[model samples]
Every structure is written in C-alpha cells, then in structure tokens.
Target: SRVSLVVVLCLFAFCSAEYFEEEEEFYPPSRFPIDPDANRTMCEIIQAKGYPCEEHYATTPDGYILGMFRMPQPNNVGPPVLLQHGLLDSSFTWVLNYPEQSFPYILHDLGYDVWLGNNRGNTYSKNHTTLSIHSKEFWQFSWDQMAEFDFPTQIQYALSKNAMYPKLVYIGHSEGTTQAFAGLSLNSSIADMLYGYVGLGPVISVTHMSNLWLRDLLELGVEWIWNVLGIYQFLPTPVELHSEFVWACAECPICCNEVIELICGRHHGAFNNSRMNVMSGHEPGGTSTQNIHHWAQMVKNPTFQKMDFGAKRNEEIYGQTTPPVYNLNNLPKSLPMMLYSGSHDELADPDDVQTLVTTLEGIVESVYWKEVRKYAHLDFAWALDAVDEIYIEVTDIMRDWVEGI
Candidate 1:
C-alpha cells in the first residue's frame, strides 16, 4: 500500500508540473515581434509587393552576426538611406507603431530604398562568433564599438551591392543620433560618405532630464543583486529576476496601465488618458524585453563613446586629465544636419537640442527647432492626432535637402 501511494504521488507531481509548463507556454510574456504572425505577415506582404525584403546578416568586427532587413529600392535607386533604431529597439520598432504611416513606409513611398539596422545585443543581433553573450567579453562593447565598427560595415556592404556611391543619407532616433555623432566624429571615412544626417528626438545630453528616479532605483537593485550573485559586471537575464516586470509588461494589461499612468503623470501634463495609452505603447514601440536591459546599461552609464575610468585613464585616452567631450572637433563644419526635437521632451529637451546645434563647428544651413507646444518625446512617434503634422514637416525637410543635393 505504501509503495502504491508513492507511485501515485510521483505521477500526480509529474502531471502538475506538465500542466504548469503547458500553461506558461500558452501565454508568453509581451516582448518584441509582439505578434509573430503580425511580423511574418508584414514580411510576407512586403515581399509580395515586389520590393524584395530579405534578411541580411552583418558580422561586426568582433564577429557578432547582427540580423538586418534589406529593402532594396525599386529600380536600383542610388545611395540607400541607412535607418538606425534607438535604444532597446530593433528595426521592427520603426514599422510596428505606424504600420501604415511610419517613416520607413513613407520613405519607401517617396522613392527611397531603406535598409534597417539592428545593433549588437538586441534580440535579433545576439549571435557572436568567438565569444559567448554569457561572458563579460560580449557585454564589453558600447556605442563606441558600434560607431567604429557596425555602422561602417553595414554602409560598406550596402554600397558594395548597390554599385552606387558609398556615402548614404543617415536617419536615426535617440541613441541612434548619439551613435551617428560618434561614428562621424571617429570614423571620418564613414562620415564623408554621409550625404545628409537626420535626427529624430536626438539626445546629445540629458543633464536637464529628471525622469531617472526609477532607473536609479533599478540600477542600485541590479548592482546589489550582482554582488550577491558573485557576478560583478555581467548583466542578469530576465528569467533570473526577482520580479517579472518585463514579462508582466508583455502579458498583463495592468503593467501597461501602470506604465501609462506613470509616464503620463510625469511627462504629459493634462494630456488625455486615451492619448497617453497610445503614446506609452508607441514609446517602446516594438522593442524586445532583452533590448530593454541593454538600454538600462546606457542609461546607467551615459558616455559619448565608452565608460570613462576616471582621471588616469582619461589622461591616457585624450592626452589630458579630463577626457575630451567625444572629440566633436571632427564633426563636419558645414555638413547639412537636421535636428528635430519636441518642446516638452524631458529626456531630450529642445533647449539642449539647441545647445548641441550651437556647439557644432559650422553654421547648420537649416535648423528647424519645431516647438510642438504640446509635443512630448513620446508624442513624436505616437500622437495619433499629431503624426500628420510631424510627417509633413519631416517630409518637407528631407525633400528640401534632397533637392539641394
């Protein structure tokens, strides 16, 4: 009888375990490519339209194979636009929010071939040839390595295949803007290839922003946990966390509800709750959960290039006690660069945008500091009522620049 009871207990435990496992599998936490079917559908539709969208792999100098989407221009257009996404975002981030009216679709409509770039460490760009992501060596890279290596590789490969001029027009958002500046400043070869530069919600400095309280708390938590785990520098995976904030955000509407409330309360003063809901969804757009961790690293350690190791290392790098501010001296004195900013962007203040523009060496022929009086950072992409205004302005600016070229 005892032996029979033991067997029954084991069977019951196994069945329970299998049941939970099946339940978890049925409901995946929200992450990028939110709907795989939606992503596959979009890819299929793009291909069916005859533009030839293919998955292209770009190997970083460090031998990381970054997944990229190549949308060839119709009739082999010259000098394709290299579209780089912001932090915690993949190329799909561009297409997800404005499935019918985003920049990529609009640019494609305007006869410009678009190639979307996904930097290393994102979900799609996580493979490495020589190093494991589980190791510190993989996480050692920052925006410095991206500008110096990844951007150049993508541009070179694009140019080689098109048989067009190597220099291409560049468009980026947020960290995308920062990487563009770093790339142009450090790699003059690539800089010269850029026909014109466009930045959306550009972030040069965040000394004015004050939305970092939650980030500060999270960083402190991560540091303490890492020390406890005997892992000093490596990032922790979502699966090993105390809370499933990432997963919750994916599967639970309550998480999105809280995020919308927090963001709206902190930034969007007097904005409609319905509009706020739409904006919060658009801020993250279609970024994956893992990408969010990579962004946390940048927020914790914001440097134009890489982390600074204090006075001695600064002296070694810049030949001075204080490290030079990212060597902005190399930025083209007369390059036509366009910076767009929202007035209420706490993260990327319009004032700071102006400061960045003024600090640049030469007279930027055209500077449109659109004070979308009611505009916030999230609004740039999400404002259901304001996208047309934003799109028209951007299209006009690009059209003028193209005409000049």
Candidate 2:
C-alpha cells in the first residue's frame, strides 16, 4: 500500500507540470505567426483578427500625409477616444498584445470609438506634398511640427468624422504627451475642445532621468553623431535589419530579453517575452535624426520647453537670447487631464512625472498612479498582465468621465 501511494504521488507531480507541447498551445496570441508585412496597416491587422477597422488620411498644414485608424462603433453610440503612439513607435503599439489585452481593442469592446494617430516621418506618415524622403527638408521636422501641424490636423479630422461626439478624449504615450503639451501651449484654444487628456508615461522633462548612459550622451550632445555618420534618419529600421532582429528574437528569446533588460529597465518578468519578435517589426519604425536631437536638447535643458537653437539662432527665432520655455501654467484649469506612469520607467522616471504633476496642478483631473509595482517603461504596452493591472482601471475612470458619473 505504501509503494502504491508513493507511485501515485510521483505520477501526480509529473502530470501537474505540463510538458512543453501542452504549454505551447496555451501561449497568448502575441506568441507566434505575426506577419510584419501583412500587418503593416492597422486596418489589415484588425480586420484579419475579425475586428472592424477603417483607415483615414489627414493632410497636415505643412503638407505631410498622416494616417489615422478608426475602429468605428457598431451603432455610433460611444464616446470617441484618440490614442497616439510614442517615439519610434507606430499605432501598432496599442495592438501588440492580445486583442483582449490591448488598450485600443478593449476600448472598442467597451463601446468607445477608437482612433490611432501616426505622426509625420513614421512608416505610415512618410509622405509629404513636395519634399522627397531623401531630401534634408523632409527630415528637418521635430516634435514641434508634430504638435503645430500633425496633432491639430488629426484631431480635426477625427472630430469631423464623429460629429455627434462633443469634445473628444485624448490619450497619448511618451512623445505623444509631449506633442499635446506643446500643442496646447502654443494654442490653448485646442484645449477648449478636449474633454480630457490621459497621458501614459508622459515625458516632458528628462533632465532628472534615471538612464545614466543616455543622460551622459545627452550632456555630451548628439548633433555631432549625426554629422559624423551622415545619418539623416535616426535608428531607421531597414527591412533587412528588421527581419534579422525579429528572427534573432524568435530563435533566441532569452538573449533578446537580456538585451532589453540591459537597455530598458529591469523587466521583472513584466513583459511577455515571447512577443519580442512581434514587436521588433514595428519598433524603431523611423524618425529623423533632428527629432532625436530635439529630445537630447530637452534632456540637457533645465526647464520643460521648446528646443534650443543656440544663442544667435535662438535670438532670431524667439527674439531672445535663449529659447523661451513653453508656458505650462498657461493651460486652462477646466481642461481635465490624468497621468499614468510606471515606477521603474527609465525614460519617464517617477521623479520627472512628479515634477509634471506639481507643475500642472491647474489642469490636472484624476491620476492613476503606478498600480503595477516595478512596472517598467515599455510594460505599458508589452506587460502580459497590463489588461488586468492597468487597462481595466483606466477604462473604468474614462467610462465614468464619459457617462458624467
């Protein structure tokens, strides 16, 4: 009887620890079979997955053609929300994880009309009226142009389509937040139309950032690198480079995780590791070197403001010795805003977020502080449990605001 009991216990332990075959079947949709080429357009990917998606094109005042995607509601009976992607990322960021977990999809499932913005110079928004992609003029823009031109154009376009919705909700990540702040600063009238703004990993002041190497690089200056390498586009992913990285990530997932950990913050297993290959296709999508230089300028500068163009040029541009700061205090107190930030985000450090919070108390509404402990920067998009830990709460808050609850 004792021998039989021992054998039964051993068999139970083995069975409980499922083998690779069984575990593989349970991996999330982000795991494998992601076609980078086929999924280039947001509509294509969403339609492929049995969701309704529509592509809308908007022309910036500066003549750049920006692409925005819409997941139209079934009966036009939902609040409109516009989501913008971060630096070197496209609209695809929102839909990287499983449909149930993705923010855009969740918003759609919750009866929100969702729109995704693609900024100028990304893979989707690469075309301009007269300027060729190879011309230096095409690569001359920074987040400033994105704010003054792209943001307003896209917002107006979305507003035009969804006329019934008064005052659209704006949600932005990383550089997206920067553009909104800049746009609103330049034209506070824009704030009059926004019902509320939700910022994820809002990056404004990076002078006190935690990334030491990046900080050092900023201090030293990044303009010289562009000149030395003759690089017009910063970190442009050639088709070969994209494919190679994707293939490497797929074949050696552990190595890929280590690389991300070394560059980004400690993962703490927050990100869905298997989806790195899927993410690689869209990341480092494309950006002008000038834009990166602008960020470097932000890091080196003491205040949250416009890009510095040296004393002489600054005098010419701003009629001052130094580039005047964007007046954060100028924002309307009635314009509702909320910020979502992670504690471990190296780029948008918690301290920097605190600075923003302290500075922007006038227009601040509700804030969802770091719910997931030790969540890093990219985890906002890639964290496997983000739906449960982050999105659900965000949706609840936005729902209340939409319903006037």
Candidate 3:
C-alpha cells in the first residue's frame, strides 16, 4: 500500500531531488542577529516579561543537557505545570505573547510555578556532555530518543527542585505531544510522577493530514541524504534572515499568513497579523533533520510507532522486520490526560486525533477531549482568542484536577 501510495504520489507531483533542491536549499550558514535579544536565554525572556524566572538544566542519559525556564511566584504553590513546545519551537512561544494571554505567565500569576522545557538540538539546549552539536552522532536521534531521554530527565529534575509538589502537570504541543505519549506509553511508570498530562494540538499519527508535500518530502528520504552529506543541523532559514523577511519587507497583509496557510490549512482569524513579526523573532527556534524525517514518517505512516530504522536496522535494534508500534495500551490506566484538537488542523487531522483517542480507549482513566471548530495547527498556541476559546477551559480543567474534584 505504501509503495502504491508513493507511486501514485510520484505521478501527481515531481519526485525529482533537483526540484526540492532548487526550492529548499540547505540553509546557508547563520550569523548571530545584531538585535537586542541576540544572546537572550529562556530565563531572560521570562524575566523580560516581568515574571520571576530561573534557568535550570538537566542532563539526559544520552549526554544532551536540556534547559528549562522556571517562573516561580513569591508564594510558590503546589502542582507546578511544565509546558513543552512543538517541533522547531522553543519556550519562546509561551512567553512571546501578551502577559494576560500568555499561558506560562497566566499560570504563574495563578499561583502555579511554570516550567518550560526545551528539547535537545533547539536554540536553548544545544550543549552536550562530550559530542559537538555539529557531530553526526549528535544528529543521530529523533523524537524516539526524545521520549526516552528528554522528558524523563526534565521531569525528574523539576521534581527534585520543586520538592514542594510531589508531582507536576505536563503539557505538550505537536511533536512534544508525540514524544510525551510515546515516552509515557513505553515507560508508564513516568505517569506516576506527573500530576496530569495535557496535549495542545496533540499529534501521533498524521497520515490523514491535508498537506501531502511534507509526506512526499519525507517518503523520498531527503533527510537521510543530508545526514550523509554531513549537514547535521536543520534550520529551515536563519533567524537573522527570518527576522528580515518578517519585519522589514513583505506583502502588505497576507504575506506570512499565506505561507502559514500553505503549511497549515487556512484558518482565518486565528493568527494575529500584527504579531506575526514579533513571533518570527524567536520562532523556527530549532530541531534536527532526523527529527523532521521522523515527523515525516508519522505524516506518511498510519501506525503510531517508533522510528522506522529500515528493515535491516529494525531487525538489529528491535529484533523485528518492522518497527514496533508504541502500544498505547501500555499507558498507565490511571494517568489523567487532556487532549485539545482543532477541526481545521490539517497537520493533526480530526480523524487522526480520533484514532489516537480510540486506541487509548479502555486503557487509560480520566481522559478529556476538546475540539475547537475553527482552529488550525498553530492556532492552539498562536490564536488571539485562545485564552477564552482554549486556555481558560484548560485552566479550569486543570483547576478541578488540582483541587482533586
């Protein structure tokens, strides 16, 4: 079936590597921005927002040292909440918005300490214990490694520091959600360490997405070739150039909006036109080529499973002919989890979200689902009315959970 799908795709769209090469060249090398926040840290961004912030680091078992921003109130309270950004995103997404609208700030103001975790290879957490960030070994990872290493390390680190709260609530968006679900499923014991889990734009299997170019790019295995060519990093464009494109010159009204619609389906009134420039300042923060390749696997394959390391390596690593599916059945039965999906989200299609929910049926306890009719992939984090349409309901749900109601 996959073979036929690829065949059919080749007939409809140009499968020439030359075409993709001409369209999306390897990002030219980057120069640090001359802007004010060029060297800004996550804590610095949090502090700039007038929130009491602290930067913390935790070293994963694989030697990647992850960084997180902690916003604690003077009167620190129980049930700290950890927010993780999606692929090519950092903690900046939570703090980039207005204080009243920002999720992390809102939570901090609500008497809850908020922690934002950055996955390895992102802008914030690029340091490794030994390997260079440019090493092919450093790039030899996907979200599969993340679920196994990043989440557990960060959670344990947070728990150790905030001993006041025995457990903290976990929230993840997009790829963050993928790893959280995948990690927790494989090692359900991690669930015992959390107050609850929340997924904003949760994604697992994405074969049903409206966009097939991403699936096309991935199915062609373009990323593996880049790796072999020694291009370890996967910045789509440099932040410097990104800022120029968004800030100085662009189409009057629908410039950035058009591009976003091209990637994520057109969901009008979700993104603020004025703030697009500001959001671009810190966005497309970071990720690995392998991570994108891994994501493309999800986009093409229906099975919610581990990385497809080809048949030979799959046999060597998994002792199987194919990659094993992450049994959602293995998720702890009592783990309280909330999932928010958007109807217009082409990337996290409603059908796929339903499939995830269906797979977890009779397996987990206290699962809550919310579907926003007009929201798209980015809207979960970027929508102007998010506070009223999404965050308030989320906080209310979290409030009830905190009160053990």
Candidate 4:
C-alpha cells in the first residue's frame, strides 16, 4: 500500500537551511534532544529551545494577516535574514532538526537576526480582516496572491521595524523561491529592497518533473478532482482537519517516510526519520486547494505564468485570451542571486532549474549556482547533512555581504 500520495496530497510540501566555524558537533535523533513542541506555536518552540523569540504580524493589502517569527540578534544587531517556506509548509520547517543542524538556529548562533515567514493559509497566517476563513472566497487565492501580496508586505514590515539594516537578505526554497522570482519580476522595486537572494530549490516551471504519479493527477484535471473532492480549502476543512492528517502521519513514522519519498523524490537516505514523530506534526502545513490546482497547471502546461483560469474565465478576469505571463526578464539587472538545486528533487527537476537559470542569465547581476547530486526536495530542509552541504554555502555568502557593508 506504499503507493505515491502526491496523487492526492503531499504535492507542494517544500523549502529551507547554515553557517559556522568549529561549532559543537550536534548530530540529530541520537545526539539531539527530541522535540516535544509538536503542539506548540513556532515562537513557543523557539522559546522552549532557549532562544529569544518574538511573534510578528503583517497584513497584506488583500486583507490576509501573515504571522512571522523572529529570532532576535543575541547581542549586536547582526544582519537580517528573512526566510520563506515552500508550499504547504510553515515557519516550523526550519526548526525540525537539532540546533546546530537546523538552519534558523545555526544562523541565530552565528549572530544573525532570523525572520521566519508563514505564508497565507498556513497554520499561523489564516486570518483575514473581513472574511471568515470558512467562506470559499477566503480560500480563492493561489500562490499568485502570495507573490503579489505576502512577500512585499512581510519584507516591508521587517524593514519598517529594523532601521539599522537598510536591506535584508532574502532566502526561499521550492515555491518560496518561485514566489520571489515571480514577485521580483512583477515588481522590480523588490530588488531595491533586497541585499541578495538565495533560492534553496529554485523552482520556476517544473519542465522535467519526475513525479509521474503527481504528473498523471495533474493531467487528469485538478478541476475534476476539485469538484469531485469538493475541495476549496485544502483538506475540505482547514487547520484542525489538516492537523489531524499530519497527526496520523506523525503516529505512523514508516508510512510518513514513504510519503516523503514519493512526493519529495526517491532519495530518502538523507531524511531524518528518527524525530518524524515531532516533525510530522507540521509536515503538511496547509494551503488552498486552488494553490495545488495552480501547481498542477504548472505541470500540465509548461509555462511559469500566472495561474490559469480556463479561457472564458481568463477573459473575464484578466481581460485577455490567456493569463498574463510573469515577466522573468524584468528582474533587476543587479540582483545578486544564490541558487541551489538537488538533482534528485522530484518537484524541482535539474533541467527545470537550468531553464530558470538560463532565463536569469542577463537579468540578474550574478548567480552563484550549485546542485547536490543526492538531495531530494526535502533534503534542503530536513536532511541530516544539510548544514555541511548547503547551509555553509549560504552562510559564507551572507558573511561576505555583511562584511562588504
């Protein structure tokens, strides 16, 4: 019964990572202290981990309030780094591992002010100023809305609070990376506010996607499934029901690992299943069904354009024959970008990443690119060796940027 589950869910569960000199070598699950904060908020979990934490909120122009967690600088006001998680994930994604191995904590220990963003509709950011979350209109948005609203609002909020840091560094994984790409392209002013951009599993369009099960589902028509399943908010009901589904996975570690492999890719050796009992509690964070449908459209159609409404709806909504494409070429010519991709990532195919990089060639200032041959989509977030493999690379760049200023 270990069939692929991305057919139904587990599709966009995605991104994250590192830094330091001869720090205490903290290995996970064995040497690591277990996570008992499964039922806790990200701020509570961070506080319990003995870190100073603050909860911040930003209201997007569309009325949704995004919740963010900040790990303040220990002593001096170090450079600010804002992190965005991928589809169906929350800020909790960066804290699933041990302190030394976890990206947020490692950066915190390195004296960086870390800001974790929860995308709209995730566990933390579910509130809208005027709409009840139960209304279908509240769930009408996809990542299209996220790019247009969430990033700008969150980044501006962070910048507004901290006057010392003129511009914060931006880092994203999977769809996190996609939103930044789309956001920066659609609004060139985003580059003026960013010191640099780091994309852990930079996804544009999944041209050579390897998940056949997911691909087949997209091919079958998400609209048909949306109608058949009656899904508006993902999981029909949103938070409580989604939490129960994750609870089932947390209680069944073996099955959870199987699903991780199916959705993330075939590479599982790097995954840390020892603490899945805790991590799985936040595994499938939450998103709109329309978001997943939009992702399906990405797979079905080869373009990385805005979410496709059917031709008639497109005409009504966009005043066009088809949806408008996100202008990747419009990205600022001087935006320094760091891009990393895993060859084994099922969702972020190597070829697709290359296509994205090719489009970024003359648009961005400089690109630092690397591919991890064995890493799957989740490894960037949960792999045991990510600190050594990915985090150090990111931290090294951040260090240079901080020093130059």
Candidate 5:
C-alpha cells in the first residue's frame, strides 16, 4: 500500500509540470530584460567596464556618509574635476553608459582626475553615523542640510584627497547646481576654492518653472499632508516595482511616455526610450520628501530663498517674518562658469535660465541655449543625441580650460 501511494504521488507531480508548461504557452510571463548592472556601486560598475577606479567616502558635518568614486589619471597631472548629479540621482549619472557618452569617462580620457559625487540620501550615501533610515531624523534633512553640510564636506574630502591641485573644478546638474549655489553663496571660502563651475541644466531660479501641477501641490501645503500620511521619502524605487515598471514601459511605451511627460516634461524623440527602461531602475533613486517641499517653497516664493517653516517657525529659525533669500549677487564674480540650458526644459525653463544668466552676467563664461529642438530637462543627461548636442561642446570647453590652467 505504501509503494502504491508513492507511485501515484510521482505521477501527479509529473502531470502538474506538464500542465503548467501548457498554461505558460497561453500566458507567457513578460520578460523585458533590465540592466542589473545598474545596482553596482559607481566604482564597481566602472571597473566592470574595464576602467581604473577608486571609491572614496566622507562623513558630513551632521554625520551622513557621502560616497564618491574617482577615475584616476595615469600621470596624475591635471586639476581634479568633481561632478555632482541631480536630485534622486546617484553618481552613476556621470558614467551611465558607454565611454562615448559618459561625462566621467570623457574627462578621464582627457587626463583629469574625475570624481563623481553621490549626495546624501542617495542609495550610495544613505548610511549615517547616528541615525537609521527608518527614523524620522534620517528623513528630517532637505536641500538646506545638503547645502550647509553635505556639499562642503564632499568638497573638503575631494580637495584633501587631491592635494596636488590648488583648486578643483565643479560641475553640477539640476539640484546639484541648486545645492552648490546655496553652499557657495553661504560660504565664500568654498566658492573661492573652485577654479570654475560648469552647470548642466542648472537650477538656480525656478520662478518661471513650467510645472503648474507640481507648483500647485507645493503651494497647497502638500508637505503637511505628506507628513500626516507618514510618507517621508519620496519615490523610492523598490525592486519589485522597478521590475514591473520596466515591463510596463517596454510593453506599453505610448502609455508610459504620457505619464513620464506629465512629470518630466516632453521628451519627444530626444530621449532614448530603450535607455530610459534601463535607467528607470536607478533614477529617482530616492530623495527626502522635505527636499520636494523645499522646491515647492521656492516655487511659491518670488525670490530664490531658503526652506520655509511657516510664519512662527520661520521667525524663530530665520530671525525674520519671511525666509531670507539666497543672494545670487554675492557669487564670486571672477569664477569662470559655463552653463547649458535646453529650449524645451520644463523644470529649468529657458526663461528662468536667462534670468540666472542675467543675474551672473560677468561670471558666466558662456551660455549654450541648445539649438536641438525639443530638448528638455532630462535630455542633457539622458537624450540619445546628448553626445552630439551637448557633450562635444562640453568637452571642447573643458579642454580649453584645462590647457589654459
């Protein structure tokens, strides 16, 4: 009887396998292959691509551990160049793809010590000395903390590590530029320590930003609503969600682009949709909801200003009825700066960029309003035509500056 039971169980198992195989034919699982390599550290990813690299870490003033990856020059001859990525973005932005299109790879090939920074709260720099990610203290930070504590700490670490150079060159994109402006504006010494700055889709003034819905959300005290809802970190990419999203985007492109366009503005043909599928896993990597609140506060306020804590708290923290504005006029007049802005950029609207240019007339070395039509905010970093439309010109400028130095 026991032998007969064993034989029956084995037959049932075989039949189940066969039945599932037949079912699989009728409803095939979606298999949009994602680039798992994106999960690697900046250094690990670079080394895997057969490049020379090193990882560096710095503890910020408030105890956040920031990460930076460096591509060393063989001779160690030129001034170091530091590249800072935008909000919810990691250092990988500098080397997101092939050497032909990557900013860090191009700079390394040009013989400069290239360093890419991962801002506080990003995947690479999430660890802190005293706080856990689950704690409210961890999410308590905003761009204010980044400007006051994170950026300066990274700059100090980079300069100290690369003591061979008297000063370093800083390149920032989007919120990278925003935090840099805040840091350098507050601390003159930090601004003076840089030989120059290059802002790629820089976000200095968002008074003319085109995202009305986002502006309305911020203006309507959405931060308080989110706080009540217990949502601190915004748009954190989970593994399962990322996989599902990759499939959705790949299988339903038209539908996906409509949603993406609503958030990041028009991409048209400028963006490589295939690359976006890969990038989606990494980008909007993660950021504090407070940071979004900071941007919203900026939108509601006429001047480029600090974070708002409402009337009573604003008076207590800032010693005034209103939040004090960051004085853009105080930026070092002699520091060389090259800025690039796209015509169709919705987040960093062209008109707002022009306002920034006018604000820093003497300091701006050059302003490139890209001629390529339909170029939007994300295009500077993610567009398929980035190499021809932006990187070539950027390389030329960097070459000239490096040679002159």
Candidate 6:
C-alpha cells in the first residue's frame, strides 16, 4: 500500500509540473500579435484600411536595422515629407486609421511621399546587427540616439533615393519633434536640407499638466520594480515581463478609474475608453526598457538640450555636454517655420509652445496655433472630427511653403 501511494504522488507531481510548463509556453514570452479585436471600435477604424504599405529597413551607424514604412505619394511629385511618429508608437500608428481620415492620404494625393520612421526599440525596429535585443547594448539607446544616429541616416537615405530634391520638409509629432530639434541642432548640415519644419504637440518640456497622475505612477512603479529586480536598465521592447507588469498596473481597475477621474478634472469629460485602448495599442505599447532612464533624465533636468549625460560623452560625440537647445536664438533670421498646438494638450501646453516660439531667432513668418477648443494631445492624431480641419490648414501651409521654395 505504501509503495503504491508513493508512485501515485510522484505521478501527480509530474503532471502538475508538465501542465505549468505547457501553460507558460502557450503564451509566447513576447507581446507580438496583440489582441487586434479587444477595442473593437478603434480596431474597426484602424483595420478598415487595405492600403499597400510596405516596410523598408535602414541600418544605423551602430548597425541597428531600423524599420520604416514607405507610403508612396499617389502621384509622386513633391519633396517627400518625413513623418516621424511619437514615443512608443511604430510607423503603423501613423496610418492605422488611414481610410477613415485623409490627412496622410491627402498628402499622398497631393504628390508628397510620406516616409514614416520607427525609432529604435519599437516592435518594428527590433533587430540589430551587433547587439541582441536581450543584451544591454540594445537598450542603451534613447531619444539622443535617435537624433544622433536614426534621423541622419533616414534623411540621407530618403534624399539619396529621391536624388532630384535638394531639400525636404519635416512633420514631427511629440518626441518626434524633440528628436528633430536634436538632429538639426547637432548637424546643422541637415538643417540646410530642410525646406521647413512643422512640430505638432512638440515635447520640449517635461512638465506636463494633463496625465500627471498616470505619469507619476509609471515613474514611481518603474523605479521601485527596477530597483527591486536589480535591473538598472530599460527593457528593449514592450514584450518583456516588465512591460507586462507596467501595463497591468496602468490598466488596473483602481488605477484606470483614478486616471479617468484626473482627466475629468481637466474638463475632458468625454474620455473615450476606446482612445485609451487604442493608444495603448493591442497590448501595452511603447514601454521601452531604457525609456524610464531617459525620462528620468528629462524630468529631473527639464531642459530643451540634448541629454545631459555630461560633457565628456557629449563632447566625444555631439561636441558639447548639452547639444545646442535648438538655439531659437540662432534660427535663420527669416526662416519660415510653423508651430501648432491644441488648447487642451497638457503635454505641450499653449504657453509652452508660445514660449518655444518666442525663443526662435527669426520672427516666425507665419504661426497657427490651432486652439481646437476641445482637442487634446491624442486627438491631434486620432480624433475623427479634427482631422479635416487640421488637414486643410496643414496641407494649405505645405502647399504655400513648397510653392515658395
């Protein structure tokens, strides 16, 4: 009897262990193939498009083969406008809802090729020639790397492909604008290649008014967990275990309710759950392992300068501890640039944009701060109603600028 009991116990233990192992394997350790059906409303609009969007690869100086999307202009006439997406989002985020809106599509119709860039560490740009995604080298990059390496390579590649053009215009949103400034400031030669620059909801300052509570929670949570795990670095992509943890907290019943309350206090009463769902992507998107480190630098030292790692590293590469802060004081005295803002955009408040404008050395030949009475940050890209008004003004500006050039 004792011998039989022992055998049965051993069999039960083996079965339990096997079941757990299979369960773990079923949910691939990565976060790819995110649930495309969770937020049906948002996915309905995003997935409606059947456009032929192809992915192109470019290698950085560091040999990172970054992923980019080439949305060919319908007629292919004007200079290609490099479309830089915001933090944590891949190029697909730019055209995910293309069929419903015509901003990007209109640009295509107007003969402007749109080359959307995906920054390092995003899902699309996940491979590197020398570094493995699991290594610290992969996570070493930040927005600084994007400005110094990614943008220059992408621009040169774009201009090389379209050799007929001497200059190209730029449209960057959020951190995209930050990197644009960093690129121009570090390599003035690239500045000569730009016909005009348009920054939408630019993130020059880290002192955000909206989304304060959520941002705080994220920073605190990351700091605590990373410290506990003895992980001093950022995750390479949002598929890792850490990324999952952060997302769970952000979307937790209590945390999400608190976030809604905060947004409501900001007078954004109609906070669409679908928008939040979409912004987070099919899974929790944009939680780079190195993101918190870079963000720490940005928030701790609120300056429009290149990352403040110290003069030695900066000088070795960028020639200064602080890359010139888009020396608004040095902008071509007559350069025509446009700065647009949303009234309810807490990230890039109207005051902040105005302050940035004032820093420009030249009198901005034209300025249009779209105080879309109720528009917020995400709405600049996702709001169905705001796109028409935005595209009309944007395309008109581009037409005038291109004509002048």
Error of 6 at 334 (Å): 4.8
Order the candidate numbers by lDDT, best to worst: 4, 3, 2, 5, 6, 1
Summing lDDT over every window of 10 consecutive residues in candidate 2, give the lowest-scoring window. 15-24
In model 2, the clashing pairs are none
Q: Rate the local accuracy (lDDT) of all candidates.
A: 0.57, 0.73, 0.75, 0.77, 0.71, 0.58
Of candidate 1, the 10-residue stretch with the lowest lDDT total is 233-242
Worst 10 residues of 4 by lDDT: 12-21
lDDT of 2 by residue, 1-405 (tens): 244323422322332221223222323344455455332556777776678988888998888999889998877657788999888678988887778768998888888888999999886888888898777788888898888898888888888887677767898988899999989888888876787888888888887767554555465565675556555665444443445557667666677666444444455425666676766666655677688778877777758666777899889988998877778777766677777788778888888888888778645444445534677777777777888777787787777677632
Better of 1 and 5 by lDDT: 5
Candidate 3, which ten residues in sequence have the lowest lDDT sum? 12-21
TM-score of candidate 2 on Cα atoms, chains taken together = 0.85
Looking at model 5, residue 365 earns an lDDT score of 45
TM-score of 5: 0.85
Encode model 6's per-residue lDDT on 1-405: one tens digit a residue. 244333422322332121122123323243323334333332243334543354578999988888776665444445777877776555555554444463566566667766777778766777899887656567676787888798878777766666557677788877788787777666667777777787777777665545453355344544445445434333222232323433443354345333323422242323334334333433222434456456555655557665555678878867766644545443443445666677877666767676766665344455455556666565555556645647667778878767522
Per model, how many backbone clashes are there? 2, 0, 0, 0, 0, 5
Q: Which number leads on TM-score?
A: 4
**TM-score against truth, every candidate:** 0.72, 0.85, 0.86, 0.88, 0.85, 0.72
Model 2 stretches astray by more than 4 angstroms: 1-40, 75-77, 258-269, 362-372, 403-405
Clashing pairs in 1: 30-250, 167-193
- lDDT preference between candidates 4 and 5, better one: 4
Native-to-model Cα distance after best TM-score fit, residue 108 in candidate 2, in Å? 0.2
Residue-by-residue lDDT tens digits, candidate 1, 1-405: 244333422322332221122123434544532322232433553565445676788887779888778777656774477788765455755654443446666677777667888777764676789987556556556666667777788777666666655567788877678778877787665756667787877875665554553254334444344334433222211222212333344455455555433432233422233222222232332222222334444455544444444689768866777534566667765567776777777667676677787766244454455556656665554455444656666667666655322
Q: Which of candidates 5 and 6 is the stronger one according to lDDT?
A: 5
lDDT of 5 by residue, 1-405 (tens): 244323422322332121122222332355655455545656677887777898888999788999888888776666788888887677866665667677777777777788888788876787899998777688887888888898788777888877577677888888888888888788867866787788878787777888665576564565676577566776555444445555565565566666455556676435545555556555555678788778877776667788878789889989997778888767776677788887888888888887787777754444444434677877777666787877778777766655433
Deviation from native of the Cα of residue 32 in model 2, angstroms: 8.3
